[model samples]
Target: MATTEGDQKLDKSTPEGAWKKLLSAQEYHILREKGTEPAGSGQYNKFYEQGTYVCAGCGTPLYESETKFNSGCGWPAYYDNLPGAVERHEDRAYGMIRTEITCANCGGHLGHVFKGEGFPTPTNERHCVNSVSVKFKPKE
Candidate 1:
């Protein structure tokens, strides 16, 4: 992968450049380039907090703190998303098939969704999100 000077380190020197400076290459790839960070490796899997999770790319509101749940899948799981805030696509990457979710506004890759979540919620959907793709703002 070609690394731009911007890609070497997150340009966190300014609030506007924080995302670029704080995130790693893989994080930049998955979050900004719409690539997938390998599952079972995201930090949000073990995150238990009360906060709103916003898109790391554009700061768009995506999931509420209340919607988060543990799927035991080593990834951050949510039963729902903020209405009309995301777009889905059929991802055929790496010879495997999965549904890809992206931020509706900036088109930054969030993660994939899977069915059969076994949750009692109406959606029964599991939105497996990447931690690098999101930033949690805890409720006060």
Candidate 2:
């Protein structure tokens, strides 16, 4: 079986059904069902190695390591994403208006992006992503 840079398996068939079989339950829950993992529990929340963050569902390169920062909000936070990698949609679930970020390639839910939080990064935005939705590929 061929794997992506993040080591996530790829299925070239129809996404609607193939994803359910390709991804794990947790990955499907968050990636397909727009579920969020508990804060501070994701593996990449505290991990600070040089790497690229890719979508777990399709393995599309989404975020770069340099853009990641310690925002203390839990669930790996990034200040920016790779160009043309992520897509933002208006998410009004849970009685709150938020911008949900997803993999542009596979339409997999990654997490939400919070803006105007006054972060020190170039963009005052925090991309709070679930670890189950992404995988790390260390720089070679």
Candidate 3:
């Protein structure tokens, strides 16, 4: 962490307060407060570069680029997540029930999962995620 503001440094090795120190206000809001970014406003919404999408709060690999698809639903849409990388919970906010996905290792909010969408993907699921909650690491 930088003593001077705006000079952010991520100390990813530590799990305690590391995310709070590293994530920006907007990132923290979505990842910690479970806030959602405006539709079609996320950076990863249309991105198709080969990489892995990891939890921005904890650096844990969450989704693979191969699983990504253009669902035209605004936010980044994936057919599946990396096995065991995410945990699902029943989200009952806004009077509707939805499955919320979070980073398994850090408990940071990723987004919601919608199944039975009838997409051509192997898994008929769409993991709607906020770009601020995740970061992309290009394949090596």
Q: TM-score of model 2 relative to the true fold?
A: 0.90
Compared with the true structure, the alpha-carbon lDDT of candidate 1 equals: 0.77
Per-residue lDDT tens digits for candidate 2, residues 25-101, read 99889999999999998999999999899888877899999999999988999999999889999999999999999
User: What are the per-residue Cα lDDT tens digits for candidate 1 across 41-95?
Assistant: 8777788888888877666789997888888877898988999877899999889
Alpha-carbon TM-score of each model against the true structure: 0.77, 0.90, 0.87
The stretch of ten residues in a row with the least summed lDDT in candidate 2 is 6-15
On TM-score, the leading prediction is: 2
Candidate 1 Cα deviation (angstroms), residue 21: 7.5
Error of model 3, residue 82, in angstroms: 0.8
Q: Scored by CA lDDT, what does every candidate get? A: 0.77, 0.88, 0.86
**Which pairs, if any, clash in model 3?**
none
Better of 2 and 3 by TM-score: 2
List the RMSD of every prediction in angstroms: 6.6, 3.5, 4.5
Candidate with better TM-score, 1 vs 2: 2
- Listed per model in order, the count of residue pairs whose N, CA or C atoms clash below 3 Å is 5, 0, 0
List clashing residue pairs in candidate 1: 10-20, 10-21, 10-22, 11-20, 11-21
Winning model by lDDT: 2
| Winner of 1 and 2 under lDDT | 2
